[model samples]
Target: MPASTEQAVRVAVLADSDTRWKWGALTARRLVAAEPTGFVLRGRATPTARQLAETGVSTTPPREVTGAEFLREVRDAALRGEGYDVVVLALVGGTVRAVLQGLSELALERRPVIVTGYVGVVYEKLADGLLLRHGADVVLANSRHDAERFRAVYEGVGADASAVVEAALPFLGGAPYTPEAGRDTLVFAAQPSVPATRAERVYLLRRLIGHARQHPGREVLLKLRSKPGEHTTHLEELPYQRLVRDLAAPPNFRLVYGHMGEVLDRTDLLVTVSSTAALEALHRRVPTAVLTDLGVREVLGNHHFVGSGLLTSFERLDAGVRPEPDAEWLDRQGVAAGGDAYASAFDAARERVADLLAGPALPPVSPYYTADTAPGYLPGILARHRLDVDAPEARPGGLRRLVREAARGAYRHGVQRVAPAIRRLGEL
Candidate 1:
């Protein structure tokens, strides 16, 4: 049977929740509901998929295909006698590279309108996905800065860039709770994987304990992602545990495991080293601080928070330093600007997809092309995939080599710098 335009859109979700799959599920639901033609979600054992299914959304088990096999499936599905007008690939990390490579190969035969939802900084991995040079018709960003970052990284490589306010899991509607008066408690939410850097961990611990001491009357809660495993006790190994124990008795300081939302709701001020929780706190209008000396200041700064002077140095805290709130910036970040922004973004995405389907076929580029044409060819390549990098690439070098080096650099830097910050912050 011939597939008709009126048939429900078959949207295959490539999801792994530890990454951006959770966000992908949320976006899928909204997209399916908005259009009369529903969508199908695919994932390998995702809680979000189950939730969607419970809500009566259609879902398919993620085929247990290796990265290469997955792309082959996408190619065949798009080109098979059956007409599948659009294929949305929701990917993060290395998976995106594989999908793009496959798309490029398939582009040699027939052009399929492919839309991709990337959860992290694509520029950081641009080299891995040479096919991205084909251009993504629409690129989504977790934040405006991320969108700008994408543009800065991919310009000239191919594809125009635009921002799609990342669709978030529907865990909380609007602000989850109103700020309570007389709430003087501070919560440090930590993820698992205790920090391995002795110096950094010690510094973070001292700052946290010092903050507790400064607000003597307030309760200090340490929330852990999971209960300490066999090798460690959440509190004992902590660098500042001894100091915290010496300064304040057990009752003043509490160690909590699990039930993050419950803890977040009651938190008066959220202190994070580099946890995304800071962003969540911001969305909730909860006063939050990111310990700067830990090397995550750039990320926090991009969010437009005024410098808090709250470094890892306890001496600074003892001096009664506090972060100054940028009222206007906070207001801009907190404003929900009605549903108009989201609606407009969705409309734009749909239009891009429709245009791709209706447009002239795109030409294929040789995989063996030299580095010189890499950036110039990228815009067209990415266009086929429906992603947009809003800014131009930063490096003056050839796009291919630049992307490759950038990806390697991001991997190394993220592990050496960002990962430690995340670990330390999560431990808090």
Candidate 2:
């Protein structure tokens, strides 16, 4: 509904992952879709400030930048005055800290960054989460429960209460109804973080093998987020190949990765260690069970699916356990039975974004540690942002990181050199 003559509002959504990108895209498009008010909005479509701001009336796509580039590759971009009225942080880990610092360095009215990635199984306790929650101008919460959690934490820490905006967690709400004609594939949407260690991973695989054996004809695929040596949450990089070799390479078991929709279409039963992927399976009405054998709160966020059937013991799998989807818990997570709420959330978010665009610019909010506490985090992120003086790992793309990278490279080179020798020794 933008006016034919008025300028469009440009928002740069910085994301490197699937979920962040979706939310960023949705939010950006929604903001652009807003009807024009009397105010003349401009600079919304410009990629970088060095380039001229466009006055055209069109929905500008959110500039999707990788987290690494936003954080480590900031100076050149910021120096060029290549910034946005809003920079959405859809990243986690050191990248979040680094990007915030880079934005602060630009000193261009401290552009408002809408902090995102607030959802179930709160990573809010982590360093990156803490920094993002405190640092962002607007913190988005997927559910009222999550919003309350954010509010409680902010209140306890005496931070800005106005930043939190509870909204429906963005989802692929319009998945085509997949009919189960003859599909019987059982999929484990595996996580590198779950199963904790190498030994635990082996145990889980062994359990899967045992369960697969029970259903003689069923094919089981372990879906991994990334291949070996890829970036993930786990410490060790154990490949399914290694596990298969160790387990004599079972025929029915294999590692697979592709579109979730494709997998769900062919899947008879979907299982996981409390992955958000569970929501997808449940949406398809695919028989789903949240693996809770570990029951560790930090690792297994399975509690969020309390009403959904828990697959704690493989013995239950052997005994023929079926998924009992919890309509209430699912509704609360904005996954099931609450389709209306989810839709409404999108409308509200658009309204909110429009309001955010119109509101007078406020002082820059702290994007690190504790916002309420001044002189936050010894050798605080502010120094790194303004001075570009890094505080070790706390700062992104710095001297220590370069040194660590060199060391890691040398170590990896040594491993590659030694690997062939080790294989020969095993043969001998």
Candidate 3:
């Protein structure tokens, strides 16, 4: 029997970091007619309180869970005959695969409609990421171009491409760009670890400061992702915040951190190396530029904007250049600068989800990797999340569980603190 329309749709989102949480929660809203519950995976990039607040998701705080704890929750929910109607796994490819395997072992009579996809530009690990996310009921492609590429990758690997559904970046929304009288703000959206080196970060910082000095009339806002101690979707080895201290910045220049959409409201020209904020700005028809100051390299991810027409340099920007995005390129990338197309961007995804909810019970998630397929490969991915499909009884309890938590904390400390310190020493 199909699920009755009278009852509200129950949706849940499991995401690892701040950006993913924002993407997943907003996506669930577009896919279903319900307020989706949010869950954050406790990890190295588990969102700080301020980070969560800045996303403006909801007043209801999200529950934080480990891989083991989340799996257990799913099992418990299944046992209680209260599984979610839809679940968006907003996590890395490996994490998604592990969760799929873990859920499959539960052997529930009904499984939630699983959904997963990249949060932004699919610049790296195309094959590896796609394969890991293969078994989701809806592998959402954020644009028409992405949908084609996703399908091609799956079909090339002889896997089912039926799940690649077209969608848009759920968080892409703001009032259309309009100039504020006498206040032209230049917002440079900063990423945490794109440049990854101290020198590169320092150079970018100096350039930004220089730009502020050159144009005293324009308010140059360096939009940051997180605070000094906070972690974002990516790790920051050499934070702009630390580097900017060494330079004497102008009064017109300032560091700001808030919702990108809120910042975009005041932005006349949005600039970045390769941050997803470029896409958001374009969607709002804001004049945007992807910096080529570091060279248009794949590692910098600015290469993703090859034909975007928004790719330019600080030299061009400093000389008062605000490049307009190509309409064809915008359509391909699903920015839909024209309002109508973007309004209906989620139509296909919503339809697919509705059919699944109204259909029979979903089968076990069948990820691309398995013991028979990738014997050596599958186990390591599962083990990283402490998920052992073969040995459920091996999970620790009581005192052992406490010790495990302590160990996990120590590991996060090493990654967030000790590792960065070692990298800084190497620079010296």
| lDDT for residue 28 in candidate 1, whole number 0-100 | 52
Question: What's the candidate order when arranged by decreasing TM-score?
Answer: 3, 2, 1
Residue 169 C-alpha lDDT in model 2:
52
Model 1 over residues 26-87: C-alpha lDDT tens digits? 55545443222223222222223333333322344334333344454555666665434454
Pitting candidate 2 against candidate 3, the one with the higher lDDT is 3
Which ranges in model 3 have alpha carbons more than 4 Å from their true place? 388-397, 406-428
Candidate 3 deviation (Cα RMSD): 2.9
Q: TM-score, each model?
A: 0.58, 0.73, 0.93
**Whole-model Cα lDDT per candidate?**
0.46, 0.56, 0.86
lDDT of 2 by residue, 1-428 (tens): 22122544545566443334444555555445533211110111112211111212224333332333344334444345643445565555344555565566555543553555542356325333654546666667676767777777777766666767777655545454465665568898887566566776787788888877777677888877554433333323565545655675357777886555677777877888777677777765777877766763654666566655545556676687775766666666666554465556656555665666566664555653534443455245534333343346325566775675567556644444465457546846
For residues 1-428, what per-residue lDDT tens digits would candidate 3 score against the true structure? Answer: 34558877888899999999999998999999999888999888888777898999878878987776777777777677676778899999999999888778777778888999989998889999999998999999999889999999999978899999988898898888998889889999999988888888888888889999999998999999997657888877777877887799999999999999999999999999999999999988889999988899988899889988988988989998778788998998999557488889989999999999899888778777778778989888988888652344335455666776788778877876687678567756
Candidate 2 runs further than 4 Å off? 1-5, 16-83, 93-98, 123-128, 174-179, 233-236, 307-312, 367-428
Q: Pick the candidate with the highest TM-score.
A: 3
